[model samples]
Target: MTAVLNAVPETSFAEYEALKAVLDTASRRMAITVVGEVNTQGRAFAVHVATLGTADPLAPAIGFFAGIHGLERIGTQLLLDYMRILLCRLEWDELLVEQLRSIRLVFMPIVNPGGMWSMRRSNPNGIDLMRNAPLSAEGQVPFLAGGQRIGPWLPWYRGRVGAPMELEAALLLRVVEEELIARPVSFALDCHSGYGFRDSIWFPYAKSTRHIAHLPEMYALKAMLDGAYPHHRYVFEPQSVQYLAHGDLWDYAYDRVRAPSVFLPLTLEMGSWLWIRKNPMQLLKREGMFNPIKAHRTERVLRRHTDLLDFLARAAYGAPRWLPQGTSRQHMMSRAIELWYRRRRA
Candidate 1:
């Protein structure tokens, strides 16, 4: 843990400090690895990957990622709060102990530290990490919003053509490939904000409207989430349902990995537009568009998602119980088609 802290810049970064504190507390109980590093203006940022629970190849895992877009600090804060809770409960939580025995938990809470530190949506190089992948959208995409090589000065800049991905993006995929993709089944949640008025849980094939091969699996997880929290208001669907984009890192990673090893990468768009509607003044601030500006509002947002994170942990631990099979899986597939694809067909 000392080594991890040493690798990070000595400068004060609140999110980094919180992450270090959580890792420090859980050091004795988990494995911590400094996966990679990013440097911006002479200050180096460490990308740490922490793993909790059994390392059995057969066990399911969940990878929690936030802060890919640095301006969306709520996503990073939500993850930090969740990790803080988990670390504090380590001594007395027997269920958590049991959970650790059957599942692997991976956290990469601050993937683009430089962007966060600079209060920019893109990394230090001005490239959007999410849009820096090698893949391109299959059809016509919405100008810059869909990503472009128009250059880094503009928003949604997809890095130079044929160039390698940004360091943070590369590191994220490396961590996912090593920690989560190696398992039989895994789900990754990359949290973000500023998409729409309602919260959403989006799964991939962001490059096209084509359904991912694991739609049934995704639907089963959605069903589990819905059944567990009857009144929850998360809209679950494919990313293409809203808009298609180029170089979505999750889509690239999901495409690289094949079936039998189900890797469902989901993006949790936290609906910061609702927050903006409540406080229109937030529009004036650079970070305002993507995060809740009020302290109480931020806390409420943080509190709201802990249950979802815990549910994801439990879902990974007990995937076999509700993942669906045979006719049940077919039913989920049919339902998913009706729910997500019907509009496209219409």
Candidate 2:
């Protein structure tokens, strides 16, 4: 049969089921609720939420998600991998478990279920969900889209001025409003991919605002993330302004709540190329997902898996600013010791 990860029927199901499991575990590991969802194209998509370390419901939280664009399947898969780690790797990451016990972790694994099934970037309506966030009354993509020049949403289809959330955004923002934002969250992150971009941990309104007070925290967090995976440059900044990404998820998060929000485009830096073998855009029918890799096996990809676990564990357990340092160096050291032992044995 076709090789897929776990019992995940496809990447879409992987997102759905992972959220279900995370929500279900909240009952045992923390306090949570279904939060709710909106069905598009007959699929029941939801934004799952959980609370920990307090009763104020509006307490600060750390959120993670994938599949907003739909075509960005790598993130969709990575989030799924995260769910499994959050659930099953409790022993391997006790510090992370303790951290989760302290800070609420909201997982919106599939923001565009319709797109997940179709392998498109936008939601089912052919709208780019990233650009679909709520916009100003004048209808712009926020301060970044194109300066005042690119008016009224074309080329981006950012959505109408007053449209609620473009589906998922509304639901997610609702959860934050009722729970995290109005309450206490001081930090949060949104995961994405593309550009094969390096050192891309970015903040909102990359160009305009000089909310410099927060730069140190951003750099500290960035250094921790970079240390976790040093293969790429640590490209952290306020994000660009020429793109004027209005109604963006990060824009809304930063502007409304003024939290230290991060948009991590964790693009893969390895030799692997997504479309080189099976096109990332290919659709799946009854015949099964086209040319997908079976769930990763062996240590070759173990570091990617480890990097994720480490990031979450560090976020949950270590102080928000600290991460394991010299991981690449540590690996080399361990290898050298092993080689020495082998030579001695010979």
Candidate 3:
């Protein structure tokens, strides 16, 4: 007689359950790949990738990532909600189908299921995936927040020195290389929560404040967003404007990418401090600071960000139309320097 296997504990997690449901509903339209796995508490949790649209090498692409820090459940929820919205629209929206034909959309919503399962910021190994990259800060970083080699016991640990990157980090590298990096122009939005008082959208160069080669491109994108959503509250700035950190995965990825092609990686640090101020008691709970405890608050957060996710897809779809060129590009670069860097000096 064949014995039936019991459900894995991770399968019971709400995020994983939502993931499975999305896959099951959209499997015919999406190319789902099990990129890797993380083991914790004797449970093996799968890292899933869901891709929509064409994989044309020349087509622009956008990747949406979340849950790198397990305790930041809002990140995962926002992405999952966005995916559900897209999938719901796909059944009847000809505009969406036509758009999908022109560009690629990639999702890796739950990057660190093991960490999420344990409700920890770092993975089961106690290493922060954001800080697990091989690159180091070009200059001094803020104490432990910059990343440390003080072993897994401490937060912001970078894993053992000279060791291979964590599995989640490797999988992210491979996904970007295959989807976004290969395209002529692409963007990545990695969602995170529990940062500061204001919702912020940050670009690369987390290792230093020096300008990126694609500053002009970044400025153009910011301009488009500003024009499109004038009342939007996100504070768009370079990650270094806040504080430099060691081993930022996006910075490492941007440095490794060769010239000529444009790749913009953004981190969406949702402002959980606002939630804490609204519900002051949340600060007392372990995971509360990183997530909204009330159902209505969570729904509001999801409603606010899904439009931005949709906007990125359309932006990637129409990149050639708005991406600056020649003299316009030069002017934007100069303006970017004057706006961001010069203002910092003053």
Top of the candidates by TM-score: 3
Candidate no. 1 TM-score: 0.95
User: How big is the positional error of residue 286 in model 3, measured in Å on the Cα after superposition?
Assistant: 1.2
Q: What's every prediction's RMSD, in angstroms?
A: 3.2, 10.9, 3.7
lDDT of each: 0.88, 0.50, 0.89
Tell me how candidate 3 scores on lDDT: 0.89
Instruction: Give stretches of model 3 more than 4 Å off.
Output: 1-11
Q: Please give the distance, in angstroms, between residue 115's alpha carbon in candidate 3 and its true position after superposition.
A: 0.3
Evaluated at residue 316, the lDDT of candidate 1 is: 90
Candidate 2 has an lDDT of 0.50
Clashing pairs in 1: none
Question: Can you write out model 3's per-residue Cα lDDT over 40-96, one digit (the tens) per residue?
Answer: 988888999999998788989999999999999888889888888888899999999
Candidate 1 global CA lDDT score: 0.88
**Candidates ranked by lDDT, best first?**
3, 1, 2
Off by over 4 Å in 1: 1-10
Looking at model 1, how many pairs of residues clash? 0
Q: Please provide, for model 2 over 1-346, each residue's C-alpha lDDT reduced to its tens digit, 9 standing for 90 to 100.
A: 1233367753345556655655566466555556566566666665555544444354345555566666555555565556555666664867665665555665566667776666665566656666665543233334433323244333345655555557666766666555555543344445555443241455655323333333334445555666767874435545542233555565665556544432222222222333223444333332112213433422223335446534643454344334223564355434433432234346
> If both were scored by TM-score, which would come out higher, candidate 2 or candidate 3?
3
* Per-residue lDDT over 1-346 for candidate 1, one digit per residue giving the tens place of the 0 to 100 score: 2354456555646677778777888788779999888888888888888888898988999999998998998898898788778877878999888889999898899999899888899999999998999999998889899998888889999998899888899999998898888778998999999658899999998899999889999998888899999888799889998889999999988987866788989999999888998999989999899988887888888888888999999999889887878999899999999889986789
